[model samples]
Target: MARPSMDTDTRPTRLYSALRNIKWEYLVAGISGGVVSTLVLHPLDLVKIRFQVNEGYGVTNRPKYNGIVHALRSIARSDGFVGLYQGVTPNIWGAGMSWGLYFFFYNSIKTKLNEGDSKRNLGPGYHIMAATGAGFTTLVLTNPIWVTKTRLCLQYDKPAVSTSSVHYKGMLDALFKIYKFEGIRGLYKGFVPGVFGISHGALQFMAYEEMKTLYNTYRNQPIDTRLGSAEYVVFAALSKMFAATTTYPYQVLRSRIQDQHRDYGNIRDIVRQIFKYEGIRGLYKGLGIYLWHVTPNICIVFLLYEYITNWKSNRPDNHS
Candidate 1:
């Protein structure tokens, strides 16, 4: 038999083609947006986590929060101004890694689903699938970081530390300590609720993409047309609110499961305790604070992503 033609032998495999078509700009923009947003709003994030884990079980050691204002002032007065940013290190790392990987994987999967043409319009179902895949991947990679961040934030800077309370000097120390003490299971304490939380991202992205597509269609532009900052802000905020409102309960569950102060048997046990003691409102404990923290966060991330991608696409060298 004759040897295969040079063209046939040199043809790139499907995997190679897909890998080569991967647009790295999305990852860069996402990492940049995530780091910047976290730096700006980490205090609110700390407050949100604190609120979520506070179940009013009469834990004398931890500080009590009446509301967002009280929580901010109380944390500041007790732990000083620096205390508000207790989990900044791990939060930044987790946010940056998560957003970067999420956008990369989401766009990559979307491209694959569209048969290598990323500009092709995908339905809401396809968008959800892409976002879900990205969210799951990002969660697996960053769950340990989030667990460390939660523990770090929950460490109060009081004069008398509770015997049950675990103090971590920093992110690495916390990770090491958790693994040393509780093993891999400790790092993934809230993994089940976290899996459910993927719906948050999936819904947000699906709504976001649909809104953008509709807006562009209304304007008689291509589906993938670049949008203005205001447009991005509106779409991002709306989509984030939609997702956060629907999935806020799972967040409370995740925080409670990961909380160092309380150890429930499992997710169901936690749910039962919250329901029995706190009722339906307990499941949405920190929703107000969460909205305050996350709405601006999504806006910033989307704005940065859009602007950065637009600039990259318009670059002279990129055109060449």
Candidate 2:
């Protein structure tokens, strides 16, 4: 036990290992899966964003959208079909960067942390730690991308003026305008809550990794080895649902902070204002829509990721 605990050679140096594991395949798999899923599921993501920031709570001319169908109809009638994909550019960028960086850091960290023995295994706690590290690193690097995405997604109400400050034509446009008007800090609007939301990914990966480990044990196979697509989808869906359900409220708060129509000085102010006006229920405004949106999204992403990683691992040069 002492010998195993003291094993130093298996422990990786942090920076070099991370840099070395930055494979192009990870980027390809993550970007491809994210872009595909966002294309299919962006409408739901838009609805959830509208729901979160719609503090009017069903008031006339203020309700944004009465319900899902109503929201869909409203977006179509107001902004046309493209409205459904309002901030899709930044969303693609964000989603692609997010998952790409996440998988890269996650696998690198997992490989480093995994037990250096024949019967290598990791429990839930280790999984959580690895995911937490990965999540934090990804969030810090990609917060600006996410901030641009949120603003673009919520820019549904078009102004009559072509040069209106309200509209963001594209991702690069949003970045330039945000820097000009709100300065560098504007691009980081919801960064605090976004950081807090790291728990969501941490919890998701922990549950996902643990579930796969348990499944492999039951099947008497190497951990996460030779799993079928259905199994991967099931594990991905279960973990995503769990994480989203448990850590959703922070998303609402983050959305509110990032809403271009509203301005908040701080997270405490946002929370207090929401509590005063919207009450406890306000915290979970779009959970239903989010669940509907995130469930399939995660499943599709992991299904793609699993297959992609499997292919890479089975390549001739990668074999032991």
Candidate 3:
């Protein structure tokens, strides 16, 4: 039996051959990983966003959440277990689509850059460049979903009264309201910070790729050989932690900018206010929870993505 020839830029792609061969596995794996991870860590994500936006204006306002424990308890007592999973609909949509697009672009770009070298790791530089491309592309396309998700998660038992028409009933309603009232600009509020935050993925993918390469080299294994699930978890956790910490402040700013309950003037104004009112500690409001939430979530996603992609790749004549 003959092996399938690798697709290269030089070769003319015959119809959906490239699509059938290389793309579907990534799409399935990425979307599946993203949805599963979001469901598991959504409560913690809600808590993190709440804490991020809880700091207020006047001295009298104080902060709504003192810490993670207070925030979690407050949410559970007030909104019940269901409240913790608020915005999950859009959250799932955003996460799944973002990751799906991310992996597609990541693998696509990486393949293009690799030319025909199907046998070597692309190293850190190529990995960074490819990841940056994927991050920027995925984030821009999915920002609207994220905006809607943020608004939903920020909701409390008492609905926020926006001069803008109606309150959000669900994902579709939120998107419609945001469009009707805030316009396209409203849906892209956090775009600048989000663009800046793209480095998180770039840095993360670079680190993850490098770590995996090192791990493989250390084990004297080939690049195509699958690592144990535990190894995947460790590499993913480390990469996610690095990305989250480095880009965390942007997460706070993004939440506030998207919060229907609060209004922050501008990035500088928001930065100044948080620094003045809540101090340095305020900038890192829910980082502990974020790290806790993201580490295992990424671990799950990475493990599943790698395994699924590998399984499909190794299967005979398994085109999409």
Candidate 4:
């Protein structure tokens, strides 16, 4: 018996066509997966900061947690589980917006950028451009949530944690409280560093896209069949490490700006104060923590994203 010929029209020609056909199931799956993973992993983020900022206080010590499990246990012992989830609500909002927008718009933008050029996939510039757009958009949209989260997370160390000091109980509370207290300017305390941290997104997406493309090229060679789960994990770790290292100082500044007290007039004055007190290093107070936090976070994020994308692509109805 002769084999049947495949129909050329069955294959998608335009990238937008493929993106347009993506089911809501995949979008939901991606967003939910990101949320769960972020919430679960946030405690390590807390511990990483503790270690990072300790150096500033003259506590030159190594992190107690060698891995996530140890980090959780240490944090629970020291500050309780509530401590582990100090800023969870805002974390949820920030992660939801950041990841949701990044994935959704990245696909849409890449599709549009590469329109009529199917053979040539999106390059590093496309990844940078897509991430830049997503970064600025998410920064503005989620800045209030992030400010609230920072206040909540850093509030624990204060002698008295008053509602006046903390200000916001939840997302909506934070938004309304800021507006009532400081007007429109309250929501944008760290606009400069917030925008600077957009470079983190640009670097992250650029590195991830470039690395995945390299992996695809390597896998196609006769010497290698495909990347295994372990290979994927390694690539994710390396990509995150590079991105985090390159853009970590901006993150530290963003946290400081967002977590400032009412005394600080604005971002410019705050930057000046940090420079006056701590010098250039003051602006980068929690850089070590950021680096540690981002490596595992990005690893999980990309790993989950790839798995979700692959699962969606393999489903029956995903076909054109």
Candidate 5:
């Protein structure tokens, strides 16, 4: 007369197992670092997005920016001091959630690969594997948020004449309108290019981890040995520079695909138009601003991540 409740009982056990496996310290540190860095550096990001979508024409009603200083001055002039932070709401949420999930997944994958041996050096291959998995997971989950951010950053006070020209009051409004008008595909507009951009994170993390491993080995210290903030900054900067320069074109492509003012048939169409009109350099629009934006962003993220993790590990209660 009674059906087995085994499935119900096992569900909670499985949930508990998953929760137990997560390293909460990594998640907290990652969210904190990402939110803080984005808060301090969002203007550069806004400028970068504007430049990325501008294809040498008046694509939107936004003011033209001749250079970094000019762009800042022009935005402030047109939209006032608050103009600089157009898409910061979605940007902060995206950054925090993305980084937190990335670190959580990355460490989980690495732990699985290590097979409970924390002292084992998994090397660069394992690092790459973990980072790639984490990047893919994070990208898919957060692509919609990024699409919303791009659109919001690209929004102007004055609307363009195109019927396709749209505006968002805020992050929630953008998501709802995009979904209502364009369906799920609209919310994931840049997802294809974002998939390629996964390499950016994978390469950055792999390089960062490798440098830390090598430094510890050279110092004859444990692989987990904590380093000073200055050391973390140097390593993060180098790794980010390498990754950013190598993988920047995808960012331009993603921004262009996500641009509300212009529409392209496909990635190939976008690439062909960009190449035909702007040449190879078209693919690297805003790279200088990107470099300026990301260098310090990575430094702060990695430094805080390391510091937070170290602090957690050193806590007396954490010693068992």
Candidate 6:
């Protein structure tokens, strides 16, 4: 009974094999994390938009509440908790798909890029490659979800009488209804800005990767071992902030394109409208609120993800 050969060229290392096997776990974790985070943070997201869009609404400015709590209070007082979670269905759908795609492609791309590279010398280029791959993948996979989420979130307190068609009730309802009303085109109202929004995703991954690399470099240690909990939070927050700042105007346009009620002749017309009506300032309408909303959320997400990944990787059974 000869023991299995450890030096066989045909067989991959245990760690390499294990890493390849966790694709489903990555998807599940991404989707579940996204859903839970969106639900918890949605109320704030609502307020953030209100503050961004409406000038006279006069929402509270307390740092603690940000926009969501104020919106929740206003809605609850005016409407109910129902208002707090106005487009919950779309949010969940968007989050689940967006995050699932992000993590799946991010891991896949990073793994492929790392295949021949020595683990001792992974560089900034690897991070950029991974981030770019994740960003592009997320853009295509979740654009429709974003379009739906924008519409649902932007439903006003006052309904207007218009000639345009109205479709969707919540998330799934909206999805099916949109398809029925306008076919495939209805669900992709903001395709142009949506594609542009890829910049945000790319920047996010780039920032995260760069920050991780920088930390590892400065400390002269392996990132997997040297990155502390606080470091993860800091890196995540900084990355999100940088990404948000660099591409915020596109984000505003993307939201507006999705949520608005207008018959633009084409993407050019929509862009013209955005610039004409909102001006330079209008293009950046929700920049502040976005940073407020996205930064902390990303920080928490990375923190949680790193902790979980590290814990699982370090488990006795998972060790190389």
User: Tens-digit lDDT track for model 6 on 268-316?
Assistant: 7656765666566766766666677787777666765665555666588
**Measured by TM-score, how close is model 6 to the native structure?**
0.80
Please give the TM-score that candidate 5 achieves against the real structure: 0.92
TM-score of each model, paired residue for residue: 0.92, 0.87, 0.88, 0.76, 0.92, 0.80
Tens digits of per-residue lDDT for model 3 on 1-320? 96666765436666566656576778888999999999998988888887777776542332388777887788788778887798999999999999889998999899888885656789899999999999999988999999999988866645463343357989999999899998999999898889888889999999998998888888898875677889888989998998889888888888888887666787888889888888988888778888988988998889879988889655878754
Which segments of model 5 are wrong by more than 4 Å? 1-18, 58-62, 159-164, 316-320
> Where is model 2 poorest over a 10-residue stretch in terms of lDDT?
56-65
User: In order, what lDDT does every prediction score?
Assistant: 0.90, 0.82, 0.84, 0.66, 0.90, 0.67
Q: On lDDT, who's better, 4 or 5?
A: 5
Clash counts per candidate, in order, are: 0, 0, 0, 0, 0, 3
lDDT of 2 by residue, 1-320 (tens): 45655346546666567566555666677877898899899999988998998887422333356788899898888779988888888888889888988887777777777743324677888778888888889888888887888888866554664333567878898888888898978888788888789899999998998898888898888885768888989989999999998999889988888878776779998888889988988899999999899999998898888778778666899876
RMSD of 3: 5.9
Error of 6 at 33 (Å): 2.7
- lDDT value for model 2: 0.82
Question: Candidate 2 clashing pairs?
Answer: none
Score candidate 2 by TM-score against the native: 0.87
Q: After superposition, how far is residue 241 of candidate 4 from its true place, in Å?
A: 1.2
- lDDT preference between candidates 1 and 6, better one: 1
Kindly list the per-residue Cα lDDT of model 4 for residues 180-213, writing each as its tens digit: 8778877877778889888887887788667767
Give the Cα error of residue 256 in candidate 1, in Å: 0.6
Q: Give me the displacement of residue 78 in model 1, in angstroms.
A: 1.9
Q: How do the residues 1-320 of candidate 5 rate in per-residue lDDT, one tens digit apiece? A: 99769998799899999888778988998899999999999999999999998897546455678999899898888888899999999999999999989998898899999996777899888888999899999998999999899989988765554344466889999999999999999989989998898889889988998998899999999987888888899999999999999999999999999988887999999999988999999999999999999999988898888888788666999888
